[model samples]
Target: MKPRLPQLDRPVRMPSRSRILAAVIMLAVILGPFVGHLLGAGHGQAATPVEPLPLDSLLRQAEDQSPQVLRQLLLALVMSLCCTAIHLAVTVLVVVSYESHSLMAWASRTPLGRITLIAGTAMVTFLAMFVEILSWAALYLQQGAILPVEEALYFSSVTFASLGYGDITLDLPFRLLASLEALVGILMAGWSTALLVAVIQKCLALRFHRTDHGSDPTTATNP
Candidate 1:
C-alpha cells in the first residue's frame, strides 16, 4: 500500500518580478519616441534635404544644442517612468489572474499543452515589441520625418531591429529621436528574450515536478 500526497487546493504562482520588468521595458520602448516627439515639436521643423555630415560633425552639433538635448532627455525620462508604472500595474493584474486559474499546472500536465503555452507567451512578447515599434512609426509620420505610414513603419521596424540599413534617413534633430528609438528597441527585445526564457524554464520545472511525483509510488494511491 502507498500513501497519497495531499492534493493542493491552491495553485502555484509565477514569479512577478521578471514579468514586471519585461512589461516596463515594453512600455518604455513605445513611449520614449512619443516623448521625443512632444518635446521636439516646439523646436520647429528639421531642415529638409538634409546634408550628410561626418559622424564627428553630427556629434559636435548634438553637443552644441545642450538645452534642447536636455529637454528631450528629461521628457523621455518622464515618459519612461510613467509608462513603466502603468505596465507594472497591468502585469500584476495579469499575473494574479493567471495564478488563480492554475493555468501553468494544467499546461504542465501535457506536452502539447506546454508547447502551446510557450508559443503563446512568445507571440505575446513579440506583439508587444511590434506595437512599440508602430508607435514610433506613427510619431515619425506625424513629425514629417517620414512620408507615409507604411514607410514610417518600415523604417521603424528596421531601426528597432538596429539593422541600420541606411536606406531611409532622418535629419539631425529627428536622428537623435531615431537613435533613442533604437535604444528602446534593444532593451525591450532583450527583456522579451529574458521573459520567454523564464516562461519556458517555469513550464519545464512544472513538468519535471509532475514527472517526479507521478513516478513516486508513495505519492499515488489506489481509489
Candidate 2:
C-alpha cells in the first residue's frame, strides 16, 4: 500500500494585495500575444506587402539588397523575448510569495503535479526563445539559404548563449540581436539558478522536518 502523507505543516496563504498585482501582470502577459496578433491582423490589411520568405527570395535579398529582412526577423524575436521575460517575471513574483512547503504540499496532494507545473513553465520559456531564434533564422535565410534544422537549433543556442564560434556570421543588426540574447541568457540563467536553489532549500527544510518527526511523532510535538 502507498504510505499516507503526514499532515501538511505550512500556514495557509490568503488572497491579498500582492497576489492581485501578480495576477494582473500575468494576465496581461498571457493575453498580450493574442491581442498583438489581432492588432497585427488589423494592421496587415492596410500595410504594404512584406518581403517573401522562401529560400531563394531570402538569399537574393541577403546577397545584394539591404538587411531589412534580417531586421524585421529580429524585431519579432525581440518581441518574443520581451513577452517571455514578462511572463517569467510574473512567475517569479507569484512564486516568491508562496509560503514554505507549498510546492511540496501540492506534490503531496497529487503525483507529478509539481513536475507538470514546472514542465509547463520551462516550455513557455523555451518556446519564447524559439520564437527569437526563428526570427534570426528567418532573417538569415532570407538573406542567404535555408540552414538545416539541426544547424539552425545549434546556431540559435550558441548565439543565445553568446558563444558565437564565428562559424555562423550574420548581417550587422542580427549580430546585435545575438549579442543581446546572449547577455539576457547569462543574466537570467544566473537569476533562475539562484531562485531555484532558494526554493529547493525551503522544500528540503520541510522534508528534513518531516523525517525528524517520522523518527518519533512526539519529537515534533515536543519541539
Candidate 3:
C-alpha cells in the first residue's frame, strides 16, 4: 500500500474571552449609530441640529454625568452577573439530580418521562427568570424611575423580554439601564434555550445508547 497521510485530530480552539469581548465592543461601536438612526427613523421625527457647545462646557457636562453613568454601569454588571450565576447553579442542580437518581435515568428512556422532564425544567427556569424580572422591577420602583408598582413590573417584564412595546418608557436617567437589561435578557434567554436543547439531546442520546446495548439506563454513567 502507498504511504498514507496522517489525519489531523486536534480539536478546534475557541476564541479567548478577551478577544470575544473586544469583538463585541467593536461591533457595538460600529453598529450603534446605524441602529440609533433606524430607531429615530421609525419615530417619524425630523432631526434638529443644535449649536455645538464649547470645549469647556462639554468637559464640565461630562464630568457631572460621569458618576451617574459609572453607577448605572456597575448596577447593570452586577445584575447580569448575578442572573448568570443563578442560571448556572440551577442547571448544575438539575443535571446532578437527574444523574443521581436511577429512577430519573430510567424515566428519561421513555417519551412520557422525557416530556415531563422538559416541562419541569421549563417551569423551574421560568420561575428563576420571573424572580430576576421582579428584582429589576423592585429596583425601578425604589429609584422612583417608574411610578406605581404595577407599571414598574410591566416595564421590567417588557424590557427583560425585549418586547419593547414603547407604550411605557423610563426617564432619561434610567433609559441606559433599561437598554442594559434588554441585553442581559437576550443573553439569558439564549442560555436557557441552549440548556433545554442540551437536555433533550442528552436524553435522546442516552435512550439510543441504552436501546442499542440492551442495558439498564440506570447503570449507565452520565457524561
Return the top candidate by TM-score: 3
Backbone clashes counted, model 1: 0
- Model 3 lDDT tens row, 59-95: 9999999999998999899889888988888799778
User: Quick one: ranking by TM-score, best first?
Assistant: 3, 1, 2
TM-score of each: 0.61, 0.43, 0.73
Tens-digit lDDT track for model 2 on 53-168? Answer: 89988778668645654664566576556646654774565375443344545543443554554555555455655665665556445545335766666776786667869787
The candidates, ranked best first by lDDT, are 3, 1, 2
Give the 10-residue window scoring lowest on summed lDDT in candidate 1. 214-223
- The candidate that achieves the highest lDDT relative to the unseen native structure: 3
**What value of lDDT does candidate 2 attain over all alpha carbons?**
0.59
Clashing pairs in 1: none
Error of 2 at 166 (Å): 1.9
> What is the Cα root-mean-square deviation between model 1 and the actual structure?
25.6
Candidate 3 deviant stretches above 4 angstroms: 1-49
RMSD of each: 25.6, 23.6, 16.1
